[model samples]
Target: MALAPRHLISLSDLDDGVLDEVLELSARLKRRTGRGELAGKTIGMLFFRGSLRTRASLETAVLQLGGSVVNLTAMSDFWELEEREGSVMDGRAPEHIKDAAAVLSRYVHALAIRPAPLGNSWDVDRRDERIRAWAKYATVPVMNMESSLWHPLQALADVLTLKERLGDPRGKELAITWVHSPTPASPSAVHSLLHAALRFGMRVRLAHPAGFELDGGVLSEAEDLARASGGTLRRELSLEEAVRGARVVYARSWQSLETYGNPTLTASQRSRHIGWRIDEKLLASGQDAYLMHAMPVRRNVEVTDEVLDGPRSLLYEQAANRLPTQMALLVNLLR
Candidate 1:
């Protein structure tokens, strides 16, 4: 494999060998957190929107590796600097992203950013295109915190979790099913999980309502990957049918790509919005299977409090692995 230097902007960016290396290295580094592996190194983190796990986990992970962090609420200072009436972005704004990226590159080992795409709108290609545009001129490698289309870091952590739980995933049945949510900005967890599960050679099933299919290209890519890995990708509208004989049933919500761009009236149609809920019936189908979900989940919507807190739930383990998985990513990209 042609390994390059820096950045983990997408899951597709890393192949199997590179991905495994990062996972192994992360385990080793986490065991030696105080040894100062990156004592003098610093990383810059910027967020254009809100965050919980993505923010806290990366900060903790980098610190454990003996690295320091510089965090910026980008949309705040960056926005003020850009929209100031007469200040001239040339002035106190001090620098544009181009300049900031270049200067920061000289100080920090890498930069991670989260630019949340508009809610209920799933235009990943557009979002990623813009990110790539900025990255083209960046001085250092850029790790995408979460982009319009993909959340590679989350995917990495998830893959590691699967590996730790079920050993090799080569023939394991893994279902990436869409659960219920009030809005479309439910997080790109399922998209990333589908891609990761397929790429890691797991037999994958995608269950979602009729009009709420995943991105066309992402689905196609996953299909190709699944075929190549000796796994299969099957889509089903019935959650029970999808979860049958699965080792893991992962649930998440995403905007219906078919309804993208019409934010005003999409939710007005109540029937469309409720097509993705995870009630008891869905869980009962996979009674013996492990339940997985990326956190910040809605209380009564996507999953009931009972299921989320139940013994079958592995949500906590999934969240905990974010630290080590990220440490692995940082080690490979920076160290």
Candidate 2:
């Protein structure tokens, strides 16, 4: 009998105490570097899509903690994987997810996966079938760099950034607004933040267009947490309403689940809200509002260069926090 290995698949996966511990450790690691706790460890990173921050940050984090990494692009480095339960192997993809995951687990101390959400099945993709398939078969702990539905590592960094800037995240007016993007983005980041904010008892104001709302299940859970934590998680259709007097204005844009898998429709839906882009006017709502984006932004579209380079923006710090934050996560999981 052995203790089950820990996996961070979602922010919701971390309880309040564990989240607090991770944030505190992240702060410490940022102030004073880690002790190379994973001197002999190896991390196998598989990306189903392209990434700059997630991969580089994790690679750096592993090395800083004295661990090595094996980077693999699923679509290029190896055979394409089939995630279905029982599928005939006659197509281009040769390897099944089960075999790929189980074998990878044997070769590395831990497995981290970032999968794309491009598929016709909202039901399957929304539930993150590929990541789940890997987790089901892998022998070692599985961490999510980013999945179809969530990005816990990014969310964790965001919380660290907020705590560092605000000192105390509780009882603060936090605005989570939606901006425009060329393509529909994943709602997981905003969802993850809402979960963290509510758990910290912050006043969370989610502002998005009519069809750009977040997942109902995530919202429901956050609402419950808010009630219990003495915080509020309410939706606001107007950005002004959401950011007014807020301490932090997190500008984000997510795909319209209503038109998921339909690019034309989703694009059309997103186009109507181009004015939703965050500019200086929006920042005026909270002069000291710490502008935050998840990165890989569509500058001048989702956010203006003015706001991004302004004194209040935490973009660079937010990005830098990813390294130490992930170092904390790896040390906690792999140490």
Candidate 3:
């Protein structure tokens, strides 16, 4: 048997071989969810942020494993702790992250946390960094629900959906569209999804409006990975042009990095680019294009109801895979 990952933070943290193992294990566990393979285990969930998929997925995965989950939400009292200065004991909140980590470790077999980034733009990458830093002191293995920088678990489920429909993604045209949003949330899903696809040699197109472009160095990094893996990367301003005949279209709203942590500017800046919204017209360009999103999609904004509920939408699968992928991650780390 292969070794398991003690904690999952970012896809970039795992090599291709390890990632493949996770995908395979997740598929198996998904098929045998009620088999009691991991009975009597417990998972502790701490969210300094809000989540729908992450929370539900982890809860379900642990239960399927015959384990239990404990959930913690960021509270006003916790925010007060952030204000305290000096010694760990002096924080405004009653508990420090280090203390919280150790305490949670005592009762749970593994730890899962979702910390929202500080800036107005949701920097999923940065969230990964913060959570990992806390994990350094945690005795138990850590699982990332969604960090500012990457959503590895989410990506795992996403690719699983792709593999189900289109076998291997290498050389397949996939579009990661930057849909219009009222705010910029760092676009972690876009960054990580593309990062994963590129690593496996898939041709990827990133479509977004001007000034709404992704991090400058990200493409170059993905390009380097693609050059070695037989995939291609393209960036465009036209949604229809990018989606034309594409095999998969992953849509999500993200805050502009240019706007960074400024919420005031995010809305105004993104509105000018509202033309990027995904609708039936965009899908017309690619009749066979498969539609995807990480969920919590804003209706009439990032996607239309027709398209979201359409024949091509693989969103439920994307959402459902969260449990098995996370279980694979948890099992790898804790087992």
C-alpha RMSD for every candidate: 4.0, 1.4, 3.1
Could you give me the TM-score of model 2 versus the true structure? Answer: 0.96
Q: Model 3 residue 133 lDDT?
A: 64
lDDT by residue (tens digit), candidate 2, 1-335 = 85667888998777878778878888888877668788988999998888899999999999988889999996578868888888888998888988887788878999999988756756668898778878888888899988767889989989888888888888998999998888656887887888888888898888999988788788888999999999987785598888888999998888887887888788888889888888889888784788998888888998899999889889899999999889988887875
Ten-residue region with minimum lDDT total, candidate 1 = 79-88
Candidate 3 C-alpha error for residue 314, in Å? 1.0
- Expressed as tens digits, the lDDT of each residue in 2-79 for candidate 1 is 334456667778878898898787666656664676689888898878899999999998898889999989656565
> What are the runs in model 2 whose C-alpha is more than 4 Å off?
none
Write down the TM-score of every candidate. Answer: 0.88, 0.96, 0.90
Looking at model 1, the pairs that clash are 179-276, 180-276, 180-277
- Quantify all predictions' global Cα lDDT against the true fold: 0.75, 0.85, 0.77
Two-way lDDT contest, 1 vs 2, winner: 2
The per-candidate count of clashes, in order, stands at 3, 0, 14
Which candidate's TM-score is highest?
2
Model 3 per-residue lDDT tens digits across residues 301-325: 8889999989999999889888888
